[model samples]
Target: MAKYGIIRMQKFHKDAITGIQKHNQREGENSKNKDIDSTRTMFNYDFVNEDKIKYHEEIKKMTATRVKRKIRNDAVLVAEFFVSASPEYMHAMSPDEQRKYFEAALDHISGKYGQQNILYATVHNDESTPHMHVGFVPITEDRRLAAKDYFHGKTKIRRIQDDFHNYMNKRGYDIERGEPSELQHKSVHEFKKQEREKELKQLEQQVAHKEKEIQRMDSFVELKKAPPVEIRSEKRIEELCIQPIEIEAAKTVRGSKVKVEETDFHELLSFSKELQQTLAAEHERTNALSREIDRYQKENKALKHDLKETKQELQVYVAHQDGEVEKAKKRMREKLVHDFSAEQKENVKDEVKRELDKQYEAHISSLSDDLTIEKQKHEKTKKELVQANKMNDSLTKMNIDYIENYVPKEELDKANKEVDELRKENKTLKAWKEKALNWIDKHVEKIKQVSFFQHVGGIQKRNKRQDQEIER
Candidate 1:
């Protein structure tokens, strides 16, 4: 596989600082991301900032020392950088090489955006991919906090990309730079969707393979466990019985003429040996079937686990896609506002404010009702899960040869159909929940921004009036 160096930047305002810290530092008790393997979290370490410190404190200190002017409430507080390469490439490297790769990237960023402005530079190993998170205060050379000064337009962004690629290449790493196209700038949602689709396809193939094996086993068991055949002839081995035959009194010179029964000693011994061999063969066949059943059960369990993981991944993707959609909508609204005249802008803002307030109330009420319904459904699902567990336990206690007798082929098919339906329903519910939550978050942030700007606008007007009076 081709290994490419990847770097992306995200801007965060003061309001998002706490969230950023919590995620980057892994401070939360419960991690929402199931992809993170917490056991490997110990390997995670920082480069620029050796100690784990609060981002808020670092931002505060940087602003106080490096920045002289006041930053706007909506100003980008931190320019968060996600730096990494293709997982395959990272995995192929030695421990020292991986550290060097991240360190070089960090050095390049610090060089471009001032080393003193760095808030934190952490390398996370717990997630699906090993990546580094670097936070810069965006303090300009003139000692002003302005993210736009560094990442204002496409030209600047393109140049930064080029520099990182060239710098890494010069550092003796054969990593390719991002392609200069829309394809190179894939959103998180698109990346996750592609990954999930590929994983789901693999899981589906595994499930199909298991089903085929189970069917083949079913046929094998039927043939192997059939009753053993009986032998019959004129001089028959009647169920392998050795009956005594009466050969009464008389005929031998040395006989005392006593009544007695005669038996064929050699014949009986030969028949007994043949019967033992047949029984041994049957026993071996039973043991073989048992082993096959055990193997099939293990594979079936693994398939179920894969399906469950796929479901969770799908839920994550749904949440991400909803968030992306909400962001796009917010961007569109901002663009519209930007294109408006000053007078028109005021009218549009007021109209939008009123509409948003009304919609917000309606959405909250709808969300409350939906949540209640979902809670009930959640309870029902829980009960179903408990019952299913009981059924599974019962199945575990069943004889392997008789599993098909208890769970017929038709019932198995029906159960699988039901599971598929439930999965689809769960996906739909998750998407709806994500949409509602993202909408709430977007509107809440917008309301805060509007209020802050309004206050700032008032201050500017008063200052203008004061200047006019002084001139008069």
Candidate 2:
């Protein structure tokens, strides 16, 4: 079988980030895809980042500084690149080789859209196919968040596949490129429907064939119900025997013996004997036919029971599959609705924030203009006041006596009392100063007397030392 390297890209808006994280990271329950084998889930690994990457946070971090403007709610926050090869190709490779294959694919994506843009490169081994789920922030080289810039048109999409295939081939993978997605790709629902239809058709054919066989057997039994050839021959002989006797009776007188030829009598005797043998053979054949019919009927009944059970089993299986499909659809529908609702809310919030920012900026600008005007007016008033002061100064520095002549007597008395209190404080400070000086003088006299005594004692000790030296 020809093996192909497969690469598919799916865009996820900001609102869908959480769901993508849940699916790619295998968070929560495995309700999304039944193919997930939890036993093999431990083998799942990230080829890019070893650490568990929170997709929402990673996208936010990528766009926080780069994307200056408020992000649109419908904007593609992340693009997951599904990288895998055909089952034959993947199964043929060793585990280490598979990891290298994924790593090479990651390098291709990272090279195209900087390694920093990769949020996560998780390879899931639990699913039916071993594929890498790469989360990428679609940030352009100019530091702008735009998924369309990289993956927008059909031409670009095709080029993406071409490049990936070429890149893988060059790296020695030797895998064929997959068919055009538009031509060969089928939705999960359509694929399942086709498979189900095929199974049901085969079952129908089986049942129809069995029914035809039963019908044919029933026809054979009905045909067998007629008497055998031997029995038929016996009936013909009896008719012949009666017809000859009737002809002879017409010729003979009443109550007279119908005299027949000896040959005819012998012939009649043989016919009677043959008739007895035919009847006995027919009786045996009839019994055998009845037994065969009974066996066929039993077999036919069994076949019909089997067909009915098969149909019932098929019905139950179909019901279960349908229920699972409906549940998946319901979950998908609810998730879509939630994502849409969240996107709409985020869009509304962003729009409101933008409007508010504009209004605030305008308000601040207006206030700044008004403040500037007020500052200018104040400056002018200040200049005028400076000139008035200059003129007043030139007119006369207000004579101190003239200004004092208007003083209230009560205020003057208050000022006089403050001066009197200050004088009392000054007198008290003088007394404390005199006491401090007298204490300093007494301590200085005591210090001088002790120094003089020490000097006398030193002279006496020197004289004693000189006397002792003279004695020695």
Candidate 3:
């Protein structure tokens, strides 16, 4: 029973002002501008209410404190309203009647929103539908925006829309409650449009690429034909010289006593020899050129094959891109049609978070276990090293004790015999003792020079320091 209409408004000043002015000028000069008189129309109307200005100023002041300066100045206030009018009411109205209705609606909304200084409100009836594009400056008397304070809560926008609808209904404009289905439909429409544009762009690019490839192939074919012209020219020159020789022969007297001039004979013979040489050289050149041409043709054929293969690959790539585009469109359409409620979305988010947390915990637990195992292995290896050092120290101490205090009977007997031999050969215990002490001192010094002290008891710490000092 009602005719539906959508309304939208935004704050646009500097650049928007320039664009709007230009557009309005163009529209005013157009012949079709008169057609709009048959439909409802509304234009800029001055709002001089002081109370409205004060209300806007208050909101602006609040916004200035919380909103960034750059964004605040550049920000646009967008408002959309959906209204429905009875068919009878719409059909009964004249163009002027419809225009007045829109003007009244605009005035009512401006007053309700307390937007006294706003400008540039326009109604459009370009489609089977009607809508409005309203523009206004965001600045207030205090030269600040109050967006943050005025629309702080999520419900504020809804409240504004409701209030505007109520105001419009009160002012005799038919208004309708919005349906969720319409919003969904609108979203789907916009999504489809975007998908179509994307697909079009991909197709255009593929066409352009194919066109370039064709151009390149044409150029290659042209290059291949270029050398045949020179060969044709050489053949033409030989034919021209043969034609002159035939004419001269026809003019000569028949065989009985044809006395040829010596100079003429020499010239003819010379011409024959030169012709033979020229033909021989030309034959050789033609053979060489033929070989070269054959080689080039073979290369060209291979290149053409490669180009064909490349073109095939390009075709496949284009097909793949097209498939991807189709797949993306299908996915987009599915997403658009599949409606998920807020609760369902929230549940999905929670489930994903829980799964991620569980996986993260499992991974961290595994890492900690690995770290624990490595730590235990490190401690065991350290303990084993300490125990091995203790065993080595015990063995070294035993060796030292044996060397310092005990001697085997066989070794002692051998040593005594060697001493007696030495005495018989030289004759003095003092000399033998001196030699033995010297050998003992040398052996001790050598043992000390070696790293054996590092494994011996009581000398381990000093040996470790000496080793460390040497390393340094």
TM-score ranking, high to low: 1, 2, 3
Total clashing pairs for each candidate: 0, 0, 1
- Candidate 3 regions exceeding 4 Å error are 1-68, 72-77, 80-91, 116-119, 137-387, 400-472
Indicate which candidate wins on TM-score.
1
Q: lDDT per prediction? A: 0.68, 0.71, 0.49
| Deviation from native of the Cα of residue 455 in model 2, angstroms | 99
Query: Candidate 3, residues 362-456: lDDT per residue as tens digits?
Result: 65564455445445644564565456556555655655565577689786566556545644544333444355446435544554344322323
User: Against the hidden reference, what TM-scores do the models get?
Assistant: 0.51, 0.45, 0.34
lDDT of candidate 2 over 1-472, digit per residue (tens) = 6588887787776666887778777897575455578888899888667767777776777789888778876677888887887767888889999999998999999999888888889998886568888888888878778888998777778877789999999998888876674654433344444545666677778878888877977786677776755355556656665654522354444644576787887787787777768776887787787788888878888888888888886786677668777876886787577556565788899999998788766655644554454456445645654565465444333333434677677876665665566556555555544554464355334433433224434544644653453233
Q: Mind giving the per-residue lDDT tens digits that candidate 1 earns over 358-465?
A: 876665564455445545644564565566556544544543334446787886666667656665655655565455446445644443344332443453464465
What is the lDDT for 250 in model 1? 64
Candidate 2: minimum summed lDDT over ten consecutive residues — where? Answer: 447-456
lDDT winner, 2 or 3:
2
